[model samples]
Target: MKYKVFVAGSGGIGEAAALLLREWCEFETEIFLGDVSEENLAKAKNFILQNSQKTSVVETILMSKDGTNEAMKSAFESCACLLDCSPGTQAPRMARFACDFKMHYANLTEYVAETDEVIALAKDAETGFVLQTGLAPGFINVLAMSLYRKFVEQFENETIEKVGMKVGALTAHAHQPHFYGFTWSPIGVATEYVKPSRVVRDYEIRQIPALSDRETIIIGGRTYEADLTSGGAADLPDYFRHKAK
Candidate 1:
């Protein structure tokens, strides 16, 4: 069946998905609903209309704090997927709702606590909830797994040297600057960035400070500084002990 996807928060990510869906309607149903003020939503809509070659068909909802559950149900009816780009605080609540309602939950959320919570809940529930479904986590995961398999196959007997990954986000457009700008709450962005980061060192999982690893990247005449991210890799310690080296 063609997927009817409901984006739970008509912010930047939601609107992006909506545009992509409109461009690829034969494959998915993209609808954006959120509690953002009407002015914000209208601005989002205008942006879509301006950038998109085709007419953007978006259904909007003004959500209230007291009525989120009902709003979610209403906007989420018949949705094959729920993409939550709401604030970090809302992710856990949305994850629980998705689990309780038997909905597939996907988010671009960066909250380790919330992601961990959802991961725990998924252990008992019959649904799949993915927290890092974009850029760093999503695509990086696929490529990393591939390299992992190759390393295992190629180094079946050799003592592995060191394993590390270099990842980054970039805009294909030269005019656009610095990876991307997601339309999300300032609180969500700040909270995730301010929190400590964790990763797998060898096989051991450990927490690393965020923005601590600064490296320079150059493309043509442009130079930019980037740093390591915190969070993700929660299962490394339980699965392996390669950190002692």
Candidate 2:
């Protein structure tokens, strides 16, 4: 169905998502881009307008941090879905708006506490509320489950030694002090590094401190260091507690 989408953040991810929706969506789409920064909103609007193959009605709204303004209310009430590309810290706020407006909510945040807050806010909501729909926690987790299901069907065995899921966000070049460079949100990297990780150990669900377990591994004839990080495993550790080691 043709519908309106409200993009909560106008930063890198938000802008890209808006552009993709306009360019790739088969159905006609009306997009409302909202952000606290006017410059970001302008840039995002220009990028989508210039790059999209299909013509769409794109509007930009200057949203308050708390989303209490009249413009925010009008946009929230109008859209069918709220695609939250804001920072992890703004997850619950965005989810709350979606729930109140009876709109579908989706976000790409790995912050554990914020995710939990969204869960609580959306537990009784009628509309769909999807959280952590990002690369590491979202796509990687789904891929692991798909592989596990395939393994059980092919081998006729649910028991497995281990299902290791690893993902790394790296830059082409590095600098002094910290070797990693950010192509995305730096807050996400910091939060995942400090927060506790949800993992399955000894066929039981456990919360282990992030980065506590570190090891060296070789992949594609290259050496790299890996560690436990928060939210990367998603809920696989819980769903496969006894089924996988």
- Most TM-score-accurate candidate: 2
TM-score versus the correct structure, for each prediction: 0.75, 0.94
Estimate, for each residue in 116-212, the C-alpha lDDT of model 1 and write its tens digit: 7878777877667777776555666656557766877887742344444456445454344424554445575566467887765655666778787
Please list all clashing residue pairs in model 2, or write none if there are none: none
Clashes of 2: 0
TM-score for predicted model 1 compared with the true structure: 0.75
| lDDT values for all models | 0.64, 0.89
Model 1's C-alpha root-mean-square deviation from the true structure amounts to 4.3
Model 2 misplaced regions, further than 4 Å: none
